[model samples]
Target: MQPVINYLNTNSGEIINSLGQHLTISFIAAIIAILIAVPLAIILINHRKIGELVLQITSVIQTIPSLAILGLLIPLVGIGTIPAIIALVLYALMPVFANTYAGLTNIDPLLMEAADAFGVSWRFKLFKIQIPLALPMILTGIRQAVVMIIGTATLAALIGGGGLGTYILLGIQTNNNNALIVGAVLAAALALIASGLIRLLAKVPLKYLTFAIIGIFTLAGIGWGVKSLEFQQQETITIAGKMGGEPEILINMYKDIIENDQPQIKVKLKPNFGGTSFLFKGLQSQKIDVYPEFTGTVLQSLVKTDKAIPHRPRLAYQQAQKLLQSQYKMTYLAPMQYQNGYAVVVRRSTAAKYHLHTIADLTQFPALKAAFDPDFYQQSDGYPGLKKFYHLHFQNVKTMEPALRYEALAKGKVAVTDGYTTDPQIKKYKLVVLNDSRSFFPPYQGAPLVRTEFARSHPQIIKSLNKLQGQITTKQMQTMNYQVTVQHKKASQVAHQFLQQHGFLVQKSSKR
Candidate 1:
């Protein structure tokens, strides 16, 4: 609830902006659908042959799952609010089209006779008689479409489109329930509000449209004023994953950097310190500017295949850099000193009881549940590839969060979890960090990903980020991890302290 309230309070301005945008998207679609559907409905009501085709076509559209529609648009249109809005508009069309036609054509024939007897033109008949009678049913269709579009709009967050869906996606990634609740509630409330507004619009006197326009403009100005004043200095950036162990360490470092040493940059660094899929999309779509990525992660994720031979960090980074440049049209710059990748760990008690020292011993424990970080190394390098490479497999394989995976081991929930080699908890919890013996996991050296074009214009961004490569050692990352997880300092505080300790601050930071 605190996160939800914080999100709502902090993002009222964004919500306001989205309300306008969402309305524009929905209204435009509704209008177009009505224009097309209503006329078609009239023609179809008179001509039975065409009616079946039209209904079948709309049903076909309605049958396509909403997620499929959005995913289908990704490669064609890429990502952002435009693709999301377009997909949502299509999702909304059928209801309005079907409803408008039904309402218009369903009007009683007696009313048409009375209008004809009065010598009313088609325009007058539609305006004064048919429309007046059809308004209730038409509004019903509009209301349903509003509800459907608003629900689907949550999916927009995946494409870098701004909406309440951002909250829901954040909530899912962070394992924070408050974000999900706020996203669900506010969107539901907005749908209701839209329904009410449409009803009120129906009652509004025709002449009052001008007054309504004036009021809308006045409110828009006020909204802009509120936005300008409220979030003026706030900055937002995406982190790109949720629950990977060392990656979470990277994000915590960033938060630590922003909060303790640099106050001038007020950042709303996003919640992606887990898996890179969302971040992958965000970066490709130009939604994210930068994030901590790794040489090996790149070799696999962007390069699209795991090499049979694992190379040294430098070789891996150089090859991945070239691949990213040529394939993703992105740049991979600098590598951190530390190396981290898949290590199999077991509880000290479990290890001691069974003498679980290596893969040979681990395979003996058949009853154990296994949890992995749900990404590259764990999926392929740690498990599937390991099975193929070394012929090993645990009976129960599950994807899980990094932080929780520790507790899962401690509590005996899972006997093994993929861990980074230098994780501090390996000492704290007395878990046995087993040797690969074969080293099937590839090298995962850290690097920052900056877009090719952005880096070309702002070379300093690459330099500034690259400075951190050798700066944060494996031991130092472990210490920072302890600060956030054990000492309970926020990630931003840790980042800032690390920066000031090492002098990454600008003189303007004096005020902060």
Candidate 2:
């Protein structure tokens, strides 16, 4: 509890910023959904067939997984707030539309008849009688949509839409319960507050209620437009990174170096941005200016190769650099010395019990359950290649999130899992990394990946980034990850210390 308090105290500014972004995204999505759904639903109340068809379509959209929706939207609309809001609006539509249609249709038939018999205009029948009576149900739907949108907005962080989801993802990846608690608690609180506001809005007079809604929407639009314009006027370079403490630290290092070397250029750090594929897509679409990439991942996942990649780090780096330039027109800069390659890890006790010393030893324990992250489960150089080369298969294999895999292994939920060489959990969990006797996995040296056009336009940025070449070692990376993950140190602080120690930045003088 105290640690959580400390985290909150230290990160209040960021928490507030994230909260603002979360509210902006959620509010925009909910308003758009209400605007589209309620009027359409009311009109369709008189046309049952079209109403049913539209409701069915919305229901189907709600059934698709949020992550899948985001993935699909990436290629079409690109990443950031736009796609996130679009996906949220789609998810929010069904509840509001269905509720509005049902409310209007289910209004007292006698009351609607009374309005008709009195010779009231059609507009009076709708605005005065049917709509006034149906207000409760409509408000109920709005409440539901607002709450749902707030919850789902967390996923926006995965695609560079800034929100509280940043803290949530970081916590999960680094095993920081304090960060996790903060994000979850704040998100729930936001939902409750929004729900309460909707309830209050339900009690207002109809005319003023309409005026209030319009005023709120107009104010929000103006504020957001001003903010967006201000942001666009600034020169910013967005640097993103994959999930994990190492990538977070590396990106912070990159940010510090580039800022120190070129003070005029503002660098925006989007740490734990997403997986390899998401980041790659962002780069291709020019949504991100730069990000860290592994040489082997480029060869195995991004570039097409009929032949096997060599195990040597230099050869793998050369091949990746050449192929990326020729194929994608992306520049792969000089790599760090550390090779954060794949490792087959097991608990110390499990290794002893099964006499597991190498990848081949796993064949003897086919019954042992294994847990793997989604990427490794699907990537060619990951599980598939390992299984084919070792002739080993676990009968009960679970596809787990990257952070959860280590916890599962530690708790004896599974006996084996794939890990990176520089993962802090390797030391924390006292796990054994089985040797790759057959050399099935390729070397994965980390480097800065940038678009060729960006590289050409900003050669100074490239010069500052190249200072990281051959700088970090595997042991040093492991230590830095441990500091961030275990000691609860900030990645930026750790990165700053490393840079100062390595003469990249001048050390600060001690104050009396």
Candidate 3:
């Protein structure tokens, strides 16, 4: 409880910023949805035949996953707020459109006959009579749309659309329970608030309803126009990264470097964009200019070559780099000093008790129980390769979150766990990384991957980034991760401190 409170207190400003962003995106999406849906509903009410086909199409759009919609739009809209809002509008359409058509078409026939007898204009009847009676139903639809949009807006964060989802994704990556709960609670609160506000609006006199709706659109238009102008004026260089502490650090490092050295370029940090697949897609599609990636991830998981490569780091890196350059027109910068490869770790106490110092030594303890992350547990290059190479099999194996594996080991629930070589938990829990004497695991040296076209356009930026090569040691990365996960520092702050201590920022400042 105290942790939650402290986290909120410290991040209150960011929380407010995220809340504002969330509200803006939802409001814009809902307003746009209303504009399209209400008119379409009126058309459908008049022509029942075509309306059925239109509704079917909208229903199909609604069924598409929100995340998938964002992905499909990335090539067309190029990510960020535009694609996010477009996806939300599509999701918000079905409820409001259906309700509007139903409300207008289901009006009492006797009332329409009376209006017809009086020779009232159809337009006047729609504005004065039919719409007035259908206000509640339409408002109800609006309320539903607003609520759903607010909830769905969180997915916007996956595409670098800032909102509460930013905190939620960060929390998941860093294993911060407090941050995760805060984001979830705030998003729900926003949805409830939106629903409540729209319900209250339902009570407004029909005379002013049009005026109110018009005012809402007018204001949203002005805000969106201003935001669009801002986006257009800036030259943005988007830096994407996969989930986890290391990626966050590297992205922040790239962001800080570009922003500080070249103030003219807008550095957009798109954190928590899933794993290698998403990053690769972004690079290939020209949605992201740069991203931090691991060498082994490209070689084994992405490239999918079954032929055995040397267990050597340089050989593996060269092969992966060549493949990416040839196939995707992407370039890998010089590798960092650290290797963040998979390692089999055990508590120092257990290591001492069992005299386990290497992968071969583990074969003697066939009774040992182990835990692995789901991806590592199933990868052909993971347990299968390790087992075949080392001729060892654990008595029992469990799949669990990478963060929880340390706790499981601490509680003696598992004798061994799969861990990253540079994980901060390794140091915090006093875990011993067993040597892969037979070299079953491939090297995973850290590096930044950039699209060749982007690199060609920004030679200075590329040069500035190259200065980071071979700067961060494995211990240095572990300490930075510890600062973020254990001490709860922002990844950006840790990255800035690393840059300052290593004279990266100093060089930038000296130029000024």
Candidate 4:
């Protein structure tokens, strides 16, 4: 509880900012959904066949997973609030549309007939007769849709859409329960508050309710538009990182270096943005200016190669650099002095109990329950190749998120898991990394990858980034990861300390 309090105290600004983003995205999506759905529902009220068909389509959209929808939108619209809002609007459509159609159709047929017999205009029939009675049901649908949008907006953080989901992802990646609690509690609170607002609005007259909803959303949209315009006016460079404490720390370092070097150029950091593929696609689409990538990941995952990449760090880095330039038109900057390569890890107690000393030793325990990171389980350079080379198979294999794997292993829920060499949990949990005697996993040296055109145009930024080359050693990286993940330090603070300690930044004077 104390740690959570401290976390909140330190991150209140970020929390408020994220809350704003969450609200804006939710409000905009809800408003758009309402505008589209209510009109269509009203129009289709007279056309039962088209109404039924539209409802069926929206219902189908509701069945699709939010993540899948985001994935599909990435190629078309790319990442950020646009795709996130689109996905949320799609999800919000069904509830509002269904309920609106149901409400209008299920209204007292006798009242509708009486209005018609009175020779009231169609407008009066809709606004005065049908809408007044159907307001509760329509508002109920809006409430449901608003609440759903608020909850689902968390996933927006994955694609650089700012929201409380950023904290949730960071929490999971760094094992910071405090962040998780804050994000979850705030999201739930937002949903509840939205539901309550709608309930209160239910009591208002239909005319006032309509005006209120429009005015509120209009102000929100204006505020969001202004914020977006402000960002667009700035000379901003968006730098992103993969999910984990190390990537987060590195990106902060990148931000600090670039901002300090060129104060005129603003640096936006998107830490724990997503997996390798997502970041790569973001780079390709110019959604992100730069991100940290590994030589081994490039060789195995990005570049098309029939032959295996050599396990040597220097050679692998060279090949990755050249291939990315020639094939992908991206520049792989000089890497820091660390190899955050893959490792098979187990609890020290488990290793001692089983006398496991190497990868080959794992072959003895076919029944051992192994938990692997999702990417590690599927990537060619990870479990697939290791399994074929070592002939080791675990019957109880589960693919887990990167952070959860360590927790599972530490708690004795699993006997083995995959990890990076510099993972802080290795030290915290007293885990033993089984030696890759056969050297199955390739060396993964961390480097800043940038688009070639961006690199050419922003040589100064590249130079600022190059200051990291050979600066961070394996031990330094492990220690930094430990600081962020175990010691619960902010990545920005840690990066600042590292830069100051290493004389990369000027120390500030203390005024008496």
Name the top TM-score candidate: 3
Return the TM-score for candidate 4, rounded to 2 decimals: 0.90
| RMSD, every candidate, angstroms | 5.2, 3.8, 2.8, 3.2
Q: lDDT per model, in order?
A: 0.68, 0.89, 0.84, 0.89
The local distance difference test score of model 4 is 0.89
Candidate 4: tens digits of C-alpha lDDT, residues 1-512: 89999989887876888899898899889989999999999999899999999999999999999999998999899877899999999999999999999999998888888888999999989988788877888999999999999999999988878799988988877778999999999999999999998899999987787798689868877977997898888699999988777888899889888878777777888776777888898899888999999998899889987766988788989999989989999999999888899999999888999999999999999999999999889988889989899998889899998778888899989999999889888888888989999988898999999999999999999998999897788778889989888887878889888988998865332310
TM-score against native, each model: 0.77, 0.87, 0.91, 0.90
For candidate 4, give the lDDT of residue 249: 88
Which clashing pairs does model 4 show? none
**Model 3 Cα lDDT, one tens digit per residue, 84-141:** 9999999988899888888998999999999999999989999888888877888888
Query: So what's the TM-score on candidate 1?
Result: 0.77
Candidate 2 C-alpha error for residue 13, in Å? 3.4
Model 1 residue 217 distance off true place after TM-score fit, in angstroms: 7.3
Query: Could you tell which candidate, 2 or 3, scores higher by lDDT?
Result: 2
Q: Candidate 1's residue-wise lDDT over 217-287, tens digit each? A: 68867977997776675544444434323454566455444443445444444432224665676677766
Positional deviation of 56 in candidate 1, in angstroms?
2.8
Scored against the true structure, residue 339 in model 1 reaches a CA lDDT of 76
Per-residue lDDT, model 4, residue 121, is 99
Please tell me which model should have the higher TM-score, number 1 or number 2.
2
